[model samples]
Target: MKVDNSAIHHSPVAVSGGTLLAALAVAIFSFTFPATHWALGGFGPWTTVTVRAALAAAIAGPCLLAARAPLPDRRQWPAIAVVASGVVLGYPLLTTLALQTTSTSHAAVVVGALPLATAAIASVVTHTRHPRLFWIAACSGTVVVIVFALSQSHGAPTGGDLLLFASLLICAAGYVAGGRLARTMPGWQVIGWALVAALPLTGPAAALALGVEPSRPGGLSVLGLVYLAAVSQFGGLMVWYRGMAAIGVARASQLQLAQPLLTLVWSALLLGERLGAATPLTAVAVLVCVAVTQRV
Candidate 1:
């Protein structure tokens, strides 16, 4: 309920603790892909994303109501709406679609490049200058990841892969812009509003899922979906916002460098996909690049 902003600001220890917690949250968020893939094996991609969004909104929605948070200001609404599109709608939709065609490990590798994409957007939109090493890292990391991803591709390009990459770009923009906007509102409040705003769009899609004869998923699939909706989306957002608040967006985005490795680990565990020794090594290279890029 009541956050003591002053207390958190005064204490480096608190900030460090918060950042650590958020890093773990991002790690948890990465596993959602394999979980999603498992779920989609039963439910279609569209249905899975829609239901997840709907459930996330359901969980966070009541908290906003209980706290008596008011509607965002007119200026805030536009930004909130854009973020809602990306987080609530775009990211999930693209990721879900991508998983249908690719393994979760492969998808995680692609998404790992998101920090670089976010940095690129920051340069364009925010005019933030980054170090050359950062670009080197980003470019190198991304190239390797893409190469690996391509190797894993069973055949020629499906429209699905392109769509997934497009979604990544859109979501990257959302991450950059949303981080800025979240500065103005409470982190939870911002996410809560975005979730509600995206409901209308997600609602009809979810309805269509039920209309189709639903394929029955095993317990693992259901568990993964529930974890994705509740923990990854809902719980992850809470910590993410706090971290973003404690340290500005630029610094906060750096945490994403670790996400790909975490996802890779989860992929190995859940999907029985192996990244071998190359995975962690590649992730370290990417992380270094991301760190360099974020420097002032």
Candidate 2:
């Protein structure tokens, strides 16, 4: 039997490319919290969430039509709805609400557990078992996040913390579902269709929100809202799902461990949110866990 050197050589290249794409997505998402904070400076939370989804749908719908993208299979609609609800509606709304009470840095640290949640959910959804070491590292990371959250709230979980936790779980489900769907369809199409599917709900909701919410919409806030719509909602997920499809979802999710740290930096630079001593410490600890899981 001949061992194929070509396959051996190709595998690492593929993984590297996938890892790069996932890392890029993480970088894009890191700005989201600060952006949301900026948007909230001018718009109410409801208005911010609904308007971003509506704007993203506007962009994605036209792109799909221009590309002559085929409709998803009837079976896939349910999964697409999950994507829409989780990332498009649930996560953004919940996180924006949470950011109302919490600083962007605090929210970023609390969300550091997102990768662990995503990996756990991906395991169940894909029915793939990782090694014990992987779970240990992931759990360790979650523990760090939980401890930080508790300490920040003086041993009680604030409403913001609870909301962030809920957003984490739902967003993980969305990530896994979108990743699986990406295996069958183009990653861009998966998110594009999900945005279009969400339009029915988000369109009306945006209209109502704008009417009720009284937005000031300053220059920075408008730019922030546009970023949420164009990049965070649409462009980031396109590469993220593609990376998840290329790599396994579990592995790709581990890459997100870097997100909170990146977000911490953005919080300081963009939002001017002061980070305490524990924030960087917790972030580094989580990154250590990320390294362990990736190696395992």
Candidate 3:
């Protein structure tokens, strides 16, 4: 479902706050792949995915109840399912699998096309037309990501590449659907509701994982898992949905062009990936395209 563009128009201050929230959310999200990379040393991808979701649901459900949030109406259920599946399930499951083989640096660049994917999702959902400049800018940013991958991997594609791309695509779909839902309810509440909706699946899976997996992972690995569940799965989406709701999907998603750059920094610091001189320049160019797209 798409929100009417006219309905989402907000005051300047609101939009600015949304932008800042989006930035904060992206910062939190950028840690996920790197954290997963480390956590995989101790936990299986399925284990990580299920356990994190279940933990998130624990927090989300209680918060929703405490706030006295209204349950979504019948019409909203389908959209909530899409939001829950894509963001809460699909993205984490795929990326956690991918990171077992892929470096965080590689994951960051491949997932860099998120803004373009988001715009494409938005176009389909809203059935809205953009100017010629917007299309050019959107495609240009994607091209830069492709070129970056080639330069990094010596033009070779890996299984992880496909998985991460799929993750980004699913995430873009969730972003669009969640953005639409956020217009009707509080943005944060959409994620909380989605988390609760996921409990039947996640809760059982998490219990099974805990039963089989070793209880004593290293401190860093434990920290990574907690971060993924608490911040990446729950907290980040709260702000991201609000931002998208405030600024409209097309414009706010463009802000995601900045995510990969932040992710790269995380990768370098946490995963020991080299932040080569070439990377920053390419990031700047892609961001310019994002800026242009937002304007057009």
* Model 3, position 6: C-alpha lDDT score: 26
Count of backbone collisions in candidate 2: 0
Q: In terms of TM-score, how similar is model 1 to the real structure?
A: 0.88
lDDT string, candidate 2, 170-263, tens digits: 9989987898888889888999999999999999999999999988989989989999999999999989988877776767777887888899
List candidate 1 segments past 4 Å from native. 1-11, 154-160, 276-281
Pairs of colliding residues, candidate 3 = none
- State the TM-score for model 2: 0.93
TM-scores for candidates 1 onward, in order: 0.88, 0.93, 0.91
Write candidate 3's Cα lDDT for 1-296 as tens digits.
33347225588888888888888888888788888876777777778899889999999999998999988999999999999999999999998888888777767767777777887778878886778997998888888877776676678757777788788789888888999999999888999999899999999988898788765578887889998889988999999898878877776776777788888888887778877776777777777877887676
State each candidate's clash count: 0, 0, 0
Q: Give the candidate number with the greatest TM-score.
A: 2
lDDT of each: 0.74, 0.87, 0.83
Model 3 CA deviation exceeding 4 Å by range: 1-8, 150-154, 212-216
Write the candidate numbers in order of decreasing TM-score: 2, 3, 1
